[model samples]
Target: MSGLGQSGVTAVKWSAVSTLARFVLQLVAQIILARTLGPEIFGIFAIGMVVLTFATFFSGFGFSWSLLQRPTLCDEDVRFAWTWQLVVGLITMLGVYLLAPALSAYFREPRAQSVIEWLSIACLLSAAAAPSTYLLQRDLNFRAGGLIQVGSYMAGYVTVGVPMAILGWGATSLVAAWLVQAAVALVASYVVKPHAVRPLFWYADAASAVGTGRAVFLTNIVNWMLNNLDRVMIGRLLNAQALGLYNVAYNLAAMPNNLLLGALQPAFLAAGARLQGELDRLGRAYFQMLATIFVLVFPVFVFLALESNDLVHLLYGSKWSDAGSVLCILFLIMPAYVIWGLSTPVLWNTGRKYYESVLQLPILAIGALGFYFFAHQGLQAAATVAALVLVLRAVVVGTTAFRALKLSWIELLPDVGRGMILSALCAISVKAGQAAVSDYEMPLLSLAASTLTALGVLTLLLVIRPQILGVQSATMVIRFFPGMAQLLSRANPSTQRGPITNPVSEQRL
Candidate 1:
């Protein structure tokens, strides 16, 4: 393989490892914190986090992505990005601190004031790390990046968060955990790959970077709004407790996408940028990525939708049972969310960054209207409206992204369609299994039985027709033991009599 191809594969592997590790740690931490702190405290933290997350969109002024997407960079580019990040970080910190009172009053949660102020420290820490982190990405050194992330999460959640929660710190533990994570990441960025930190600035470099980032900045802003608007409206229209329940459901629903697709994003963006001149190759890679993502992530969402009640009860306890229906509603939108996420890198690489921001306008408007009208009804109703809006948004964005790549729905049907069909079948089987065991009183036993049945059915289907899941038997063997495939091919008498042939190799060639 070429250097870029090797680097891309390495990045993906490390990213996957990092994502899985972080997911496991966060899952444990959330379960512990939910049990200890309860929804009211989580609600308080959620309200504060909404403000903090919004300010984060501007903390780097989108320079991190600009640096990543840039074809080349010099010391001046690094310095310029660092300078802007620091400047914006300070500004955002102060802005959030000052706005804390207004945010607290808006959420009707007075505790938000202190939480926002404390969490603002994280913005500065993240800014400090941005330049180095981007440099690591630019160099395609995801191993270091992944290690930093996993270590930071461990330091934040396991070391700090769990202990603090045990000490009865309530919502403050969450904020403290975030600050520690940021600090660890900031320290690790320099330690892993030191970069010069100075006050140097060049207007031309800064302008170029800013110009490249302008659309990305707007897109991030709009995305942040689209994501958090419902939470904000819920916090305001309902109460912190309701927002807390909604936040848990939303997070659980979003976890698979965040874990799988999020891991793939950096690699995709970097690879897409490198292959920008080769449209055909880039388009093929993009489609393959979408297919791979669907195969990996779609089933998890389907399973979550089918067993939301059991999962909520088993993992989060009866206190959070109210989030079950909300989780089900959120799961309905995840496939669309995953598709939209997969297409984003394609759009970004093609210099269509503004398209996403523009497309989100209608979705945001519709979401806001829905939240306004339905939020008071309850969490499930609000989630239903949000899911409906998401489906519409997905259709529009997916069509636009496909057109930009000059790809047709038919081209993607084999990959994406198969996964959707299989996932649907898996869901139906699990549902049927659950009904067959309706007499079971234990949620845990029922959950295990349904999960096992789903897995068994899925495994049987794959064994019967591997291609339905986009995997052939030979391909699966080759993936694990590449040399064995070559050995087997050479040992075949027909191969010696004629030409050795591998359909998969021919297709790639």
Candidate 2:
């Protein structure tokens, strides 16, 4: 395999394993916290975390992306990035401390101020780790990255989140968990791979990376605001209890997209950076990767949309009935986001960071404004607006991506066209079937039924119109699934090709 290909495979494997482990721990921790502290405390923590997450972009100073995208970063570049990250981290930490009171006042909760102040320390800790993590990613060192993530998550869960839940520390536990995770990461980075580069006091090389970094930072800030403003608004505008329910629902709805896209993103960016000048090759790779994302993600969203009510009721309880609408609407964002995310690495890695930022700003603005306009009404309104914004963002991003690849919408659409159609048809069928089945009233049953129906429909489509999935022939399937060769060979003769011939021989056959 090529370096990119091997890196992708390793990244995917480790990312999947890490994500599964992290999700399990997080889910268990959330469950314990929810049962112990209930909604009000949960709301406070969720809202505070949302704010901190937004501020985190400022702390990184865009160095992570600069480090990743640059073809030949030297020790001086690394040192410059690291030093600035420390400076930015300290400054942002102070800013957070000063801003906490105003934020608390905005949320009408005095307790939140302390939470914000405590969580601010995490900025410095995260800054300490960013260089190490960035180095791992730049080198395509998935093993190291995976180890760091898993260790940090485990530390957070065992030492802070879980213990705090047991002790009934409420929002304090959440803040503590944030601190623990960062602390673990910092310690791991220092001990695991100590850097020998001396820190640069001057900003010459740092200044060079700053422009691209700032654009990325700004884009990240806007993206964070657009994504999390609703939660922030909800915590302040609505009661903490309401915020808790809404937050949980939104998390559930967006989880699949977040996890899947999170895994794909770094590798995609790294791969795209390498393929910058190869437009035809880049476009083909982009489309195929996108198809792969859809194949994995579309069904999950469809299933969630179909079983939102059951899921909300089952996971969160009937007290959160208001969350059902939000879950359904937010599910719409997932598939669209998968498409949009695939284009971003292409845009940003090609040195079009500013262009990407320009494209992103309007979409985020629309989403943010849309959320603010209707969020006062309730979860349903907020979610609907969010969903619409996501769809619009996808359109904007897709158009931009096509233009960059020197192709039109029609050209790009054909490659992904069938997958989308199959997904839609499968979703519709699942929705209809779910409506008919009383099993959907129970969360587990409903989730299972919807999942099964969607999968079955997808399987039927894959079998009947296999060409739609780019697996038209048995040979293609075998090529994609080398491990399945033995099983596939058992198929009846009429359904199978006589033999896999060389391309030259096959042409003459």
Work out the TM-score per prediction: 0.92, 0.88
lDDT for model 1, on a 0 to 1 scale?
0.79
Q: Which one wins on TM-score?
A: 1
- Residue range 92-144, candidate 1, lDDT tens digits: 99999988998899889998899998998888888889888988877778888
Give candidate 1's error at residue 503 in angstroms: 10
Q: In candidate 1, how many Å is residue 390 off?
A: 2.6
Candidate 2 clashing pairs, residues 3+ apart or interchain: none
Model 2: residues with Cα > 4 Å off, grouped in runs: 1-4, 294-296, 414-417, 428-441, 460-465, 471-481, 484-509
* Worst window of 10 by summed lDDT in candidate 2: 500-509
Regions more than 4 Å wrong, model 1: 1-4, 471-509
User: What's the distance in Å from true for residue 45, model 2?
Assistant: 1.3
